[model samples]
Target: MPIIEMKQIVKIFEDPKRKTNLLAIDHVDLNVEENEFLCILGPSGCGKSTLLNMIAGFEKQTSGDVLMNQKRVDAPGPERGVVFQQPTLMPWLPVWENVSFHLKLEGVAASIRKERAKEYIEMVGLKGFENHYPHELSGGMNQRVGIARALMLNPSVILMDEPFASIDAQTKTDMQEELVKIWEKHKITIIFITHSIDEALILGTKVAVMTRRPGTIRETMSISLPRPRDVTSDAFNRYKRQILDLLKEEGELAKAASRSSS
Candidate 1:
């Protein structure tokens, strides 16, 4: 059974000054299976983040339903963890403390929280830096702390919104590789939003492309490339070409729409 299901989801934003309702996402249905890494790909302003927000329960859809594990998602819960573009860590706390903040909220003892935190810190490859502050770490290290924090919750799913978009290209690649390794070990469901075709191809087991604003699913593709994917291989290039062509077509359609509206 699908772990996450969205049926005819729609979102609209009201503009009081213009007396208009801006349609963000059109009726869209999607399903994510257990242990699946699903990447949502789209152009800017195409409602990819909006759709992810709905799944995260940060925003409610105008219509339709979002179901996870056969339950309706009406509010945010520990079952779903979100990592935004920014790490958003607490500057005052040390690495281990930051990772165990949620445990602290639940009134867990300090010794127990620290013990639990250390395991995840090591899992994310941040072992020796447990006592360091966020300001002392690199952007990628901070981001790993955020991931560890979310994982400490033991959530059934993880939602990532272009978490590596701000980092340098090399760091981003390293983070991607680490993420894939972590996912292989944990086997948790993840819904990641990104505009980069290469990133999606590199990370996702399946890719779902969205159209321009008033976003709808353009296509859903299963990636069959082997683990430790070879970007230079013929199979990799073939998939890349296919995704690029789809995005190019959508880009032109978006341009035409803008011209017509003007």
Candidate 2:
């Protein structure tokens, strides 16, 4: 069975001024298999994040159902972990405390929390900085702390919304490599939302492209390229070109809609 499933999802937002509903997702169906790294790509305002939020149980769809492990998702639970674009860590807490916050909430012992945090801290390569506060670490390191915190829950699925979008180019590349390594080692299912074509091509086992507003799955392409993908290779370029074309087409359509509305 698919680890995560969405059938005929439709999301509508009230446009108070216009007094009309704005459709954000239109009859979209998606599925994520176990241990698959699925990347969702689309132009801005295309409901990519909205879709992820539905799976995380942060948003309720107007119609249709979201199921994880065959159970309906009505509220957020430990079974699905989410990492937002920002680190969203507590400023006062040190690295270890931040990563183990969930355990603390569960009433786990301090010693056990510390030990558990240590494992993920090392996994994300923050071994020596456990004592440092969020303000003391670089943006990339802080994001790693967020990843560690999510992983500490041992959730069946991890939902990431452009987690590396704010880091420097070099740091983003490094983090991508680290993320792929972590995914391969842990074999966790991930639903990642991004606007970058190259980033999607590099990280995903399958890339699902969505259309502009009222987003629907335009195409879901299997990325059979081997791990540690070579960005400059012919196969990589081929996939990149395909995704680029799709995005370009969506961009044009969005522009046309805007012009008509104006």
Candidate 3:
């Protein structure tokens, strides 16, 4: 059974000024298996991020259902942790406190929260920097804090929206490796959204390529690559070529449609 399922999901946004409706996602169905890392990939404005937001319960769909753990998901909860592109950490709070913010909400004792937060902080390699605020950390380090914060909740599903998009290439590669290591240890389900085909291939057990605007699933490619994936390997190149071809076709179709509409 899948840990997360979306059945024929549809989302439409209204343009009040233009008196028209914008279709963001079009009857998309998706399933996420337990402990699997699934990546949603597509070009910009393709609704991949929108689909992720719906799963996060940060946005509501026009129709269809989102089910997780055999229960309907109507709103956000601690069970579903989200890590946005930006760190979104509190500037006033130090790294330790930011990681323990969820516990603080539940009225947990300071001592207990601190102890729990320390474990995750160390897990992300920020052991000595707990006292530093968000401003004191580098972009990659801040994202590490975000990841640690989500893991601290022991969430059933971790949702990451292009969390490393803004980081340098070298740092992004490092973070990807770190994420896979953490995932192997925790075995938590993750729904990650990204536009980079390489990122999707490196991280996901399955990659769902989406169509351009009014997005729907174009194809879902299964990846059986071994751990510590070799981005330069022949097999990796084969898959990369295939994904690029698909994206190119989708891009052309999107351009034609826009031209005709205009």
How far residue 16's Cα lies from its native spot in candidate 1, in Å, is 1.8
Using TM-score as the yardstick, the better of models 2 and 3 is 3
lDDT of 2 by residue, 1-262 (tens): 9999999999999899988989999999999999999999997888999999999999999999999989999999998999999989999999999999988888999899998899999999999999999999999999999999999999989999999999999999989999999899989999999989899989999999999988999999999998789999999999999988988998898889999999
* CA lDDT, every model vs. true structure: 0.93, 0.94, 0.92
Candidate 3 residue-wise lDDT, 1-262, digit = tens: 9989999999999999999999888999999999999998988887888888888888899999988888888888889999999989999999999999988999999999999999999998898998999999999999999999999989999999999999999999999999999999999999999988899999999999998888899999899899899999999889999999999999899889989999
User: lDDT at 226 for candidate 3?
Assistant: 91
TM-score of each: 0.98, 0.97, 0.98
For model 1, residues 1-262, the per-residue Cα lDDT tens digits are 9999999999999999999999999999999999999999988898999888888999999999999989999989999999999999999999999999998989999999999999999998899999999999999999999999999889999999999998999989988998999899999999999978889989999999998888999999999999898888899889889988988999899889889999
List runs of model 1 lying over 4 Å from the truth: none
**Model 3 score (lDDT):** 0.92
Candidate 2 accuracy as lDDT: 0.94
Candidate order, lDDT descending: 2, 1, 3
Of models 2 and 3, which has the larger lDDT? Answer: 2
- Compared to the true structure, candidate 2 yields what TM-score? 0.97
